[model samples]
Target: MIYLQLFWEFFKTGLFAVGGGMATLPFLQAIGESTGWYTYTDLMNMLAVSESTPGPIGINMATYVGFTAAGIPGAVVATIGEVTPSIIVILIVAAVLHSFRNNPYVDHAFYGLRPASTGLIGAACAAVVLEVLTSIQLVAQEGGILKTAALTLDAAAPLGGVLNLRGVALAAVLLVLTNWVPKVKGLHPIVFIGLSAVVGVVFGFAGV
Candidate 1:
């Protein structure tokens, strides 16, 4: 039953999340909230891993979530669920695309979708930025709306005191290196990614 539920949930996400992998973040976040299968932090981590690895982010995330929930079989089911809609849609599109290539309605529909996809992707990017830049967490308090508060690394510190300075520093370094330094700007993105990983390790060890 859990496996079936996982498949169905991802199928819905695949069906509606039309703007590519990043756009699926909102749906995945909602799934975490509704199913108790994962948390927002887990989703963020999943996004990181999905982006770094060699597959579509949405499928990678589904596999990770499913495996965490129910092991290998769950991973297979979740992946199939995530890709099934795309497969069906592509088949349909391929068959009808030539016939409707110049149809006004089809052209207008695609034009409308472009903006919608852009908006969804933009929203996802904003969410990622907020998650990385701020140290806030949402908590539900009794008889009230959700409360927002900063997270502290040390228990002794006051609330909203601690920030992920390491992340900020790394982001700043990468931005400067890629944008300002001509030598570094010419390097491939993979080089920067490798350097960032090493820096992350150093910061991790330094308790940053």
Candidate 2:
């Protein structure tokens, strides 16, 4: 039953998250809230893990969530669920694409979807920002009233005050190295991802 639920949930996520992997973030966030299998903080960590690992981000996230929910079987079900929608949609579209090839209505519909996809992807990105920044300094499991109040107020603070500077700095450095350095610009994403993982380990050890 749990496996089936995982499949259904991820299937829905993959069905409507049309703009690629990043776009699935919103659906995954909602799933975290709805299922209680994970938390927003878990999603943030999963994003990091997904970005650093092989395969599409959405599939990787789905597998991770599924594993958390129900171990190996959950992972299998979730992965299949994520890909099944795309396969069905593509197969159907391919069968009728020739007919719709010249249809202006179809063209207009796709045009409309472009903006909607962009909006969904943008919202997902914003949600990522909110989760990371809010959790980094704001989350408090236990504390005295003064400490709790301070944490709450800190969480509500806008911008960099609530942001995780270490994570932000790491990202900025990687971006600069990967984009600005000619020798590194051609490096595969996986290479940089591995480097990021090493950096993450170091950060963890250093208590950053």
Candidate 3:
């Protein structure tokens, strides 16, 4: 039963999350909340691991969540479910795409999906930012998302104070390096991810 449920949930996610891997973040977040198999923090961690690993982020996330919920079998089921929609859609599209390549309706349909994808990705980014750089919801737990706003770096205060100052600082440095730095900007992204992972391991994330 758990396996079936996992498959159904991820199947729906794969069917609707059309933008790409990043766009699936919102669906995965809701899945985590509704299923109760994992928490928001767990989802964030999964996102981090998924981003760092090989293969598509969406599939990796599905497998990870499934494994957490059940085990190896759950992972297989969830992964298959996640890819089924894509396979079906791709096959159908391939069959008719040549015939309808210039159809106005089809063009409009694809165009309509753009905004939905953009909105999903944007929301995902906002959620990630909040989860990573702020301690608002982490401290709240079951209290509420905005229960309190800690505005200090007093680690001894409560819930690591308002924000993850170190995380924010690291993000700033990375942004500058990846976007503004002369030679650094050209380096592959894996280098940054690896560095960030090392930094996280060495420093660790405490309250925030």
Candidate 4:
């Protein structure tokens, strides 16, 4: 029953979230609110992890949310649900190629979709930025430096309840290395992801 629910929810999300992964953020937020499976904070973390990992951000987020909610079976169901709509749509459109090929209505529909997609994607980006920058003002106000610092760290790891400065430093260093080093310019993102994971593990073991 839980698996079925997961599938239905994600199917709806994928069906309507037409733009891209970022575009899916709003729908995912709607799902989060409707299902109570997670919170806005959880959504932010999912976005971060999804972007940092392999595969499309939307699919990755769906899998993450599903797994977090109901484990392995949930992940499978959610993934299939997210992709099923695309498969069905493509098949249907292929079968109706002539009806759509030279239709001005179809062309106009697509022309309209361009901006709608952009708006959805832009909204998603803004939401994520809000989550990350939620504490900026605290940090900006000199009197609340500690509070600001705490909020900033909470944005990264909600469970730790404390800032993991080592992890933050690791991320900062990687960002610099990836941007400034010519040799690292073309490296696959997975390499950096693996390195970040290793760094996180090491820091965790060291009690940092």
Candidate 5:
């Protein structure tokens, strides 16, 4: 029953999360809230680990979440569920794409999808930024995104409780290294991700 639930949830995610891996964040969040399987912190950690290692983020996340929920079999079922839709859709698209390649409606549909994809990805980015740079765990505790968001807007909130200074510092440093530093700017992103992992380990052990 749990396995079936995992498959159904990921199947829905894969079917409707139209843009790409990053675009699935919103659905992933919804799944976490609905299932009580993981928390927002868990999702962020999943994103970090998924993006840092191997294949598509969505599939990786599905595997991780499934494993966490029901071990090995759940992982397999969830992964298959996540990819099944893509395989089916690709088959359908391939069979008819040649016929529709020049159709005005098809072109317009693709054009329309671009903005929707951008918006989904943008929302995901905002959510990540909020999680990392701000202490918005109230949403995790109470499941009130609107309430926590409103709290963030309060000018009189205590600084120490509102901002994650270490996260802010790390993000600032990474941004500078990636965008401004001549020697570092050209390095592949995986290099930073690896370094960040090492730093995270150190922070963890040091109780920071």
Candidate 6:
């Protein structure tokens, strides 16, 4: 029953998360909240792991969640569930794409989808940024303009601090190296990833 539920949940995710992998973050968050299979922190870790590893982020996340929830069989089922919708959609699209290639309605539909997907991906990025750079538990507290204004004024306040210093520093260094330093900018992403891993380990050991 649990396996079937997992399959159905991820099938829905794949069916509707029209953009790329990051666009699935919202659905994944909803799934986490609804199922209690994982927490937001777990999702952040999953995102990091998925981004760093091979294959698509969404599929990797589904596999990780499934494995964590059940076992090897769960991983297989979840992964299959995630990809099944894409497979079906692609088959249908391939069959009818030629006919719709010049259809204005289809083109207009895709045009609207572009912005919608962008919005979803942008929201996902914001969520990740908040998770990485701020205290999500504190941020979730009830309040509106006043709370936001207070946080803006007292960024380093005891509750809901402005930034994760370590994460910010790492991000700054990576940005500079990747964008400004000519030599580093030319290197493969894997090189910088390895450096980031080493830095993370050092910081972890230092209790940063």
lDDT of 4 at 191: 89
Predicted candidate 6 versus true structure: per-residue lDDT over 156-188, tens digit per residue: 433346666777788899999999998879999
Model 1: ten consecutive residues of lowest lDDT: 150-159
Better of 5 and 6 by lDDT: 5
Q: Local distance difference test, per candidate?
A: 0.80, 0.81, 0.83, 0.77, 0.82, 0.81
Q: Model 5 over residues 65-106: C-alpha lDDT tens digits? A: 888788999889988988899999999989897789999998
Ranking by lDDT: 3, 5, 2, 6, 1, 4
Question: If scored against the real structure, what TM-score would every candidate get?
Answer: 0.56, 0.52, 0.57, 0.51, 0.58, 0.57
**lDDT, candidate 1, 75-143, per-residue tens:** 999888988999999999888987898899999998999999899889767667755655544333556
* Candidate 3 collision pairs: none
The residue ranges of model 2 lying beyond 4 angstroms of the native Cα positions read 1-86, 133-161, 205-208
Instruction: Kindly indicate the candidate among 1 and 6 with the higher lDDT.
Output: 6
- Show how many residue pairs clash in every candidate, following the order shown: 0, 0, 0, 0, 0, 0
Across residues 93-206, which tens digit of lDDT does each residue of candidate 3 receive? 898977999999989997999998899889778768977787544233444666454433445533456767888889999999999999999999999988998888887745
Model 1: residues with Cα > 4 Å off, grouped in runs: 1-13, 16-57, 65-74, 94-98, 103-116, 136-163, 205-208
Lowest lDDT 10-mer window, candidate 6?
144-153
lDDT of 4: 0.77
lDDT score for residue 47 of model 3:
85
In model 3, where is the ten-residue run with the lowest total lDDT?
150-159
Better of 3 and 4 by lDDT: 3
Candidate 2: clashing residue pairs, number:
0
**Candidate 2 residue lDDT tens string, 31-146:** 98998999999999989999877787888998998998899999999999999999999999897977798999989998999999999889777657755544433343455554
